[model samples]
Target: MHMKFIGLLLAATLLLRCQPSSSVDPITTGPEPEPYRIVRDSIKTGTYLGIAIDEQAASVYPKIQALQATKGVSALNVVSNVFADLIALKERLPLYQYILLDQKSGTDSGVQITVEGKTVKSIYLNSGQQLTQWPEKQAVDSSVRVGDAISTLYDKLVAIRNIDRYTNKFEYISLMTKNLSADYDGGMSQSPQWYFGFSTGPNQMDQIQVHFRGGKVSKLYIDHYSKY
Candidate 1:
């Protein structure tokens, strides 16, 4: 009887050891996050009419000259010497402005390229009084450009997750378009300039304006201090 009991106990111990174990997986680390996704995915820079931001003045001048020669586009260079502030005047920081006229009455209705200290500062492209004209609505970047429908730009802007706080808000204002050519009698009409203001902190706001001509984007205005 004693031997049988010992045999039964040994058999039960062996059966318990043979049973499958309930597994508990070890802790694992997740994949690393990409730090540059926001910047990489965001619309940060713009290219206007073969000119880009931060391009050397020497190189850009030649291209502008070529455009003038080939396209019959008038180019004018002016230096801004007047400043309301005394310090600014004393500094003698002159802005080298290269204007591309659209055969309109005034330089205001033209593409203005501003450079400070041999660096291209800002680019403002707008259609002249004709509802369509020179500067030929070019790309601001791969994703956005002049001549694109305003709705398309809006859609692209809304889809950007970065800078949502600022990009989401927009203001629309009318820009005056006038043709001085005897037919129109210098008559002025209204076109829309959509403004989108972005701010990262107090006292500083970066702005972008999309000016429309004939219901399409004819102007792309980028601020020098803009991040987008």
Candidate 2:
């Protein structure tokens, strides 16, 4: 009986030794990383396209003028017509992946821009409001189709609005793609634009329009309705 008891004790001791140590540090994991972008707590009182125009225009617009001159275009015309495009395409301009607009009143707005090297590829504008007016509904062309861009935009909206906290406050409406006019004549074959709509309240919906050029978002429009 003593010999049997000794063998059992040895086996139990070996089993304990083979078991994982309770003191061993656990391997911890975190959420996926987000893209880099400039975020400001408040939008400057006097700013244009999220930049302080008074401080930046003199130094920045001049370079844009030079580029316009190369194309035999007048600075005034370019400034009036394609200033945003010029700023986005300019290599010298600072590149940003996202910009968060947090107002002093505690309201938050955000803009996400996708960039490839020095070129601005796409832009996403999110205003925390539900949309009521939809002027572009008639312009939608069902022939154009959107791929994963809609899904990406949906995920982005959820992240921006903290929709998980509201629990069924918003409902997915539709995702559509359309060919939009890029110029006055509508001659240029611009990339198809994606429109994602969501119903935020009873009989109220918000729409986000994303325009892509060369597989990159060239423009983003957020038509939101005030919750109040």
Q: Say which candidate scores most in TM-score.
A: 1
Over the stretch 155-198, how does candidate 2's per-residue lDDT look in tens digits? 33334334343222222111111111111112112323423233
What lDDT does candidate 1 reach at residue 161?
15
- Residue-pair clashes, model 1: 1
Give the per-residue lDDT of model 1 (tens digit) for 94-193: 2212212122232233332323233333435432122222223523332233244333432332332133332212111111111111122111112233
Give the root-mean-square deviation of each candidate in angstroms: 30.8, 25.6
Among these predictions, the greatest lDDT belongs to 1
TM-score of 1: 0.19
Q: What lDDT does model 2 reach?
A: 0.26
Global lDDT scores for all candidate models: 0.28, 0.26
Question: Candidate 1: minimum summed lDDT over ten consecutive residues — where?
Answer: 18-27
